[model samples]
Target: MSHRTVNFKGNPVPLEGPELKPGDTAPNFRLQQNAADGLGDATLDDFAGKTLLISVVPSLDTSVCAQQTRTFNQKAAQLPDNVAVLTVSMDLPFAQARFCGTEHIDRIKVLSDHRTADFGRAYGLLIAEGPLQRILARAVFVVGPDRKIKYVEYVPEITQEPNYDAALAAVA
Candidate 1:
């Protein structure tokens, strides 16, 4: 587990796994998605040969998390077609699908880590303990086509928004 800590409403909480840094290869992860056919698996390779902007959130039910997802959804339109934006959370696939439908989110892909916590553990965003136990911390990662991370932001405060401009600039 990583020694990293983040705040939630000014309360400090520990995080698991080593914090990822720039230049490091983005770890591969499998997330679940609710589809018309049924539940499906989405892996890092699904976006191979494209730049990936990953938005990590604890849950979409929260205001901050919803905003984060919506923001990236809008931003996805401006990015090149080869760039894929994904919103990952510990929420159940059913909840994620509902949120996207209710929020009218279409541009970005919403993935669930509830089943395995694979994304959370691999990315080091899992909140070890707190009221929001087992949830992910707010963070963002931009991985280039080659799979090397170009930008990373582990937001100090989970309630705040990530640096959208800086992350977008990295892709541009």
Candidate 2:
């Protein structure tokens, strides 16, 4: 009984584990972004002391990906200032910034992992052995102000969406 990797566009990518859960300390890693605005870097500590919603997406160009980001951006408007909603993806920063502008998604931050795949590997979202190798799964994690995972949802099917309500409730 071995866990299989995820595939994207017919490529293989490996997942570190079956799933992540509440009370887990999100593995620490850095995210790299090469946005036209300039390069940006962030680690777990950058989001500490805030309710963190890490929305992991495979890519930002797809409808589901767009929906997932917009869904949280809409929700972020309702949450307190102390809560931070971050959408993580392998998409280039330029594309993310473009999408944000087009969608008017200002409430949340879109972080990229173009320079390094540490984010995917650390979070166990990297799909091993697929056309989308090294891409992250459609996973969501809610981390409390203390940096402990308050909730988590890793979509079993890469093509599916994460549980938005569950992620929001985790913060609530």
Candidate 3:
């Protein structure tokens, strides 16, 4: 059970798992990737030695989510190569691939959480109730090369965007 709550269009929605904070070691999670060999599992170990910026969203089909992904994709190029930005959502691998293709989102890797929801449960962003149940709330996390969480932001409102400046500054 999670004590933290987020608003989805003014209604409070419960979330599961412990809310992560700076200095906490990031939990290793296995998320699915769209691949020719079927779905492949990508873990935090896959991005070893890099500063990871995780952008969590509910779905790519929604306008705000799409914009969030695009914004991160655009900002990714400006950051150092050691910084890897990943957008995680509950959408299927195929859907995530199509969205990336259509949106020209190549810089940032968009991963699917539909398979195990490990990323959501580990990050404590999994919405536990309401129409958006099972979806991840909008959030941002920056994990340093040593695997310690440098920053975490769980947006109070589901419909709004995260504080990109602060999140990016944490990486610097």
Candidate 4:
């Protein structure tokens, strides 16, 4: 399904929360893995003392989102061992697992926000209206080993890819 149409090549949309910036502390999140019961098995504290890259996307079923995840999976392998990457989306866990299995996405952890949209709202990347309403706007956050955000990029265009170089640099 189309995440964004050609007509909406680049349009501003309403978002839900405060836009996080560098030096801001990354919020602790407990995201769901294989269930939609509104509970999470993975928490931010799980990666304590490690650099974390949170890649937020609308839906993995879409082309841009899929490519973004795949790109990060490749990039993750080259990152420092202390760095952990996560791809968050509203897609159900089943679909996410299937996508990872088919695409050989083994490096980063792919989690679902369909449970509570907690991650989206907390990160201020939730599209509150438009065609992508209820979905997450593309964003990347790099949290340092101290859990402080070292970089933040809220991709202006919903349909476009994020700045991989900038995010990767922040991790370094």
Q: Pick the candidate with the highest lDDT.
A: 3
Candidate 3 TM-score, C-alpha based: 0.96
Candidate 4 residue runs with Cα over 4 Å from true position: 1-8, 35-40
Quantify all predictions' global Cα lDDT against the true fold: 0.92, 0.81, 0.92, 0.85
TM-score of 1: 0.97
Task: Score residue 9 of candidate 2 by CA lDDT.
Answer: 51
Runs of candidate 3 exceeding 4 Å displacement: none
lDDT of 3 by residue, 100-161 (tens): 99999999888888977778888998987768888999999999999999999999999999
User: Per-residue lDDT of 1-172 in model 2, one digit per residue for the tens?
Assistant: 2275554455545685446568877787788754567888888888778889899998988898899999999999999888999999988888888889999988998999877777876777876554566667888998898778888877766777788888888888
lDDT of 3: 0.92
Per-residue error for 35 in candidate 4, Å, reads 9.2
- Candidate order (TM-score): 1, 3, 4, 2
Count the clashes in each prediction.
0, 12, 0, 0
- Which run of 10 residues does model 2 get worst, by summed lDDT? 1-10
- Which 10-residue span in candidate 4 carries the lowest summed lDDT? 1-10
Q: What is the TM-score of each candidate against the true structure?
A: 0.97, 0.88, 0.96, 0.90
With candidate 4 superimposed using the best TM-score fit, by how many Å does residue 13's alpha carbon deviate from the native? 1.8
The CA-based lDDT of model 4 is what? 0.85
Q: Write the per-residue lDDT of candidate 1 for residues 123-156, one digit (tens) a residue.
A: 9898867577899999999999999999999999
CA shift at 155, candidate 3, in angstroms?
A: 0.4
Give the top-scoring candidate (TM-score).
Answer: 1
